[model samples]
Target chain A: MNYSIALKTLVVKEVYRFVRIWPQTLLPPAITTALYFLIFGKLIGGRIGDIHGVTYIDYIVPGVILMSVISHSYSNVVSSFYSTKFQRNIEELLVAPIPNVVILLGYVSGGIIRGLLVGLVVALISLLFTPIVIHNLAITLSVALMTATLFSLAGFINAVLAESFDDISIIPNFVLTPLSYLGGVFYAVDMLPPLWQTISLGNPILYMINAFRFGLTGVTDVDIKLAYLMTGGFIATLTLFSLWLLYKGIGIKN
Target chain B: MKALSIRNLRKTYHNGFEALKGIDLDVEEGDFFALLGPNGAGKSTAIGIISSLVTASSGKVSIFGHDIKADNAKAKSCLGLVPQEVNFNQFETVKGIVYNQAGYYGLPRKLALQRTELCLKQMDLWDKRDTVSRRLSGGMKRRVMIARAMVHAPKLLILDEPTAGVDIEIRRAMWEMMKTVNQQGTTIILTTHYLEEAESLCRNIAIIDQGHIVENTDMASLLARLHIDHFVLDLADPLDSLPVIDGYQLEWVSDKVLNVAVPKEIGLNRLFAQLSARNINVVSLKNKSNRLEQLFLDLIDTKAKGAHA
Candidate 1:
């Protein structure tokens, strides 16, 4: 329905938004990833030995990249949407003839672009510390894209629920950050006790990181197929929910 | 056919404050219609509903016969809204802002650029096309907004307090440009606190207050309904005492000058008769039209007092 133009423009604008504010949006994540590679991968990897027949550095690479993807995607949507709300320019699009689905896709596509771009940068920088390898290019790309889309939708939802600048940071600080770090980003769920392992499975991000780790190193604590299915389910659910919120004009109308 | 029609539009905030209770209005094709009210008088709410920015609780709005709720896409395509706030993407140039707005309406890049240029030039913003929107002055930013709204060339233009904070010179220019647009067959609907502007430019006006339309009529008829005029009399002789004129309110500001309010039908003939009867020599007399500001204040004050009663 002539969505390609809308998608393309939105993605370009989204990418430009973060790129234009490189110090605030892009640099902090890159520096944080560097620290993770240094303190977690090198200092801790030497003590832990190996995980699933791979060195700790290589094992953590996929998780680090996936973490970057999730944070970047979520932040992109939240900040962009919140800024629009603050500036009130969103009324322009709200008053236009465009379909709600098109607006959803356009904003989501922007988030995806930022998430994937930052993910690529993180992956490339990891090579400086340790050699990287790919087990399945298709699975790797699919998992990364789907995970970005899912988190971007989540960010969109957060932005819609947020009423102020403080509101925008609440979910990321209290919910998203804690969920990502505990969702097996640093270690395999198998390393936990059986009860803890089962509980960790409940975290949606665990499935996404595991699927991505499997794509990169062909090793996973959970079944690779289950990981793929769960991530796909997440993407579908979040997309539908976000579209519903858009149609209802949440946070947009009084 | 009516270019725009609204029926029983109502809006209430979550905090239980009713911004718009119920308003009905109709703007004819090629008409320059103005919606006039004071701050917090529901002018913005009415415009917001018509432009689809604010949803009505229980009402209907249509653009050129298309129901906004049922055929939003078709209805919205026929409308262009210039909001009161200067909200825009600060990072983009003026040209980019206009172009992106057109793209949002599903226009192709080529067509969007063409329309953007045309609109920019029309708003006299062509010289500042490449500058970022943030760097422009307040007036320039307002002009950029007008350009963005006109990019799609909608059949109806809705402006919400377009010149609220602008200077008089810029406001005059904006009014002239708006008149040109109205002349081109794009029905213009604007809301403003400037009563003089509405009196001079609008053929029809609607006065909304407390979510209800208190007054709606042609400009001429509304002015005639006030039925008030003013006379400034210059006397040849110094007045130690004021002369009482029946059926006219008089104030003697100085010995040589006296101001009076008289019904329009009661011309200066009666005033001259009173002066001659009192042996007051008259040097010169001038008549002044009733100022719209007084009428607006009187209407709103009367309405407010009535509500309290």
Candidate 2:
């Protein structure tokens, strides 16, 4: 099998799908992130003053960037893959000779590309409202890539188990959005009540956001090494789970 | 080598519905084979199993010389399936759908592009290449799928009701297209509700009923099994009633027409001699229905009766 050609075609198909519907997939995240910067950064940051020795707007930039990465990555795979199953187009791939791992990696790469692209867009948008600086370039890129892969895999799992359009929406609405909002996209967990702060510590999104924050503003409540470790662990666990689901043909095979 | 081989293939769905019951089949390379069955008789299940769309309970299927279990990729590489329904991305352009399918089969970009163009032209879809599939007519969409499936030029092409719901003219055109494809040394396997289509295109036939292969034989041999043929004969004079022939069954269709079920073993000469003695001049005689259709019905009907017995 020519893995390179197969991977490229899958990735290209994925990218073309979202790009063709730019208004739906690409523009909404940009506009939503811009609104966040305008309202939270300019309208409200003045009163909140500084956070962790930096301007309030600067503090939330990393969180906002991670939020876009997570949302775009997850939604891209969930929507794209679930539609493939729903439409029965996955039969094309199932009958093809491409390896299961290549399918997984190809879709994940698509999610990563969309997630990082949206993340970059949000970051550039943030620059107009706040001066941004990256404390660790390596950490920032890796964390972004890891976060995208993590959610993209989650989306794939959701798609495999999803039987309808409503099933796809349930996860992003009830679980992902709530976890992301409370995951410290706007405020540091340190400012919350001790019990709430403890609960926040348990949220995986917190580790991701804070790790990305450490790379951006050089400030985080948790150890940065633990943050990277959590990212790696999530990738490994999700990769294994996704591959197993594909092998079992869960909700996909007859 | 056989284009396809299936041995003891069986499938019991999760709900315990046995779609196939240990069926075995073989198709010689370059042969046009028809797999015919009633609505729940397991034609789809057999095709699904061979295409790897549905899991079989127990069976061995090999394409060419590659075993599905041992060499899945190589086995799949030799087969192409156009499903009974539309399965392509509805939002993608016709050209894009064909190009991507070629790529999925591991064709490089340049070769994929060339084949995409060739298939589109062959299927008469080149003019609609830029149109998204959702915008095309139902017949056009089906053609796009055919083009997509043939993009890789697989050695074996399997079409399940490829012309179902298509208009007669369009169906004829597709039949012509597939004939050309088959003549190029590609084996063709088809399952269809249209018995006429199968009788017209396929050289060999298999009839499945209640999850069993009731009959499998060459097309000519199967039709030959019809020891009786029914012909509608127009008479120069009005028949007063049904005529009495020793070996032939005759019924008056109208005042001037007679329906005769002629036995193949008994000569039409005998029937003509008997009619002439009765002073009945024959104006014209023609077959009552397609020979294969008669045999297909008789086979399925006999199986139904045997099952009840």
Candidate 3:
């Protein structure tokens, strides 16, 4: 199979879908990230001096960046795939001789691009409030990519389950937003009460945010190695689940 | 060789609504076959099953002897489908959509581009290659869809209502292009409401109604079985009493025109003899009803009454 060309074309199409509507895809996240910095980092940081060794502004940057990545990647796949279903264009791909794995990868790759691009924009904007430092660029980059892939797969699952536009928003509004907020985007799990801290451990986004936090500051609320292992594990699990969904022709067929 | 073979095909949706029921069909290589059905008939469901867009509840479909369930890749590689709706990446250019479709079938970039150009030029869409699909007119967009479907040049091409919303001019052009494609050894299956198109283009036809094949035969035989004919007689003078024609039925539509129906075994000579004997002067005559419209309506109406009973 000419997988290389297929992958390239799929990736380019994926990127162009969101990029063509930058105001809808990119600007909203940037604006939201800026507000988080202004209200949470500057206004609230004045009262809370230091949660860890670093100032509150520097500490929350990684979490905010990771949050943006997760949201952008997850939303990108869900919306793009759902739109294809809505427009009935997905029939073109379904009838083709291509393997399901290629379709999954192509769409996931698009989500990852949007996630990474938005994360970069958020990071640059965060730097205006405080100079951002990278303690381990490798760890930071790998975690970001892997986390985006994980969420992209999750989004694909959501899109498959979705029957309408309202179905698309339900997960992001009810599940994703609540999870990200409670996952330590603004406050470390250590600062939460014992019961709340125990509950936070079950949230996968907590691991992602803390791992990314470790990569940026060389300090972490959880073991950084455990963070890496958890992120990688989530990616593998989601990948297998997505492959099974594709093989069964889940929503595309029936 | 048979290009497609379907047996006992069935499809039921999640809500327990059965869309298809035991549809069996075969299209030989190099034949243009038309599937004619009403709006709610299972034409789309049958196409969906053959193209693998919808899973079957029961039964089997094979393309060139390759089973759709067991060896789907091989089966799909031999088939190309142009869906009823204009579904494509609207943000991409026409060239991009065609090339990407080729890539989905695992073709290299160079080969994809070459085939894209060929198909687009054949569809008269090469000039609009760089234009985004959303910007093209509906007819042009449908042409792009045809180009995308032909990118890989499959042996069997299934067009589901390809001219649903197209203009007469583009529709004719599309039909010509499809004829040329079929002439090149590709088996074509078309589902359309345009009975005239089927009459002109298809040699074999299957009339589907309520998920079953009500009539499947050669076009000539199907039309012959209906036993319908019409004749128009222009009388030399306005007549108060119509001439009683033999071996035919006649109705006076106007004072000067006599509508006539005759069996194939009888000729116009018998009708003329009867008219001449009655002192009915005939100035001109014409045959008006080799049409399929009345037959289709009668078939549907009969089926509906049978189901209600």
Local accuracy by lDDT, each model: 0.86, 0.91, 0.88
Q: List the residue pairs that clash in candidate 2.
A: none
Error of 1 at A227 (Å): 1.5
Candidate 1 per-residue lDDT over residues A114-213, each given as its tens digit:
8998898898789889988899999999999999998898888888878999998988899888888888888988889999988998888888888899
lDDT of 2 at A235: 90
Candidate 1: stretches off by over 4 Å: A1-3, B231-243, B252-258, B269-290, B301-309
Q: Between candidates 1 and 3, name the one with more favorable DockQ.
A: 3
For model 3, residues A1-254, the per-residue Cα lDDT tens digits are 56667677788888988998999999998898898888889999878988778899888899999999999999999999988888888888889876778888999999999999999999989987889889999989988998899999889888977889999999989999899989898888888899999999998888888888888988777877787788888888888888888787787777
Could you list the iRMS of every candidate? Answer: 1.7, 0.8, 1.6
Model 2 quality (TM-score): 0.96
Better of 1 and 2 by DockQ: 2
Model 3 TM: 0.91
RMSD of candidate 1 to true structure, Å? 2.7
Instruction: Give the higher-lDDT candidate: 1 or 3.
Output: 3
What lDDT score is found at residue A212 in candidate 1? 90
Query: Alpha-carbon error at B240 in model 2, in Å?
Result: 7.6
Alpha-carbon deviation at A156 in model 3, angstroms:
1.0
Best by lDDT: 2
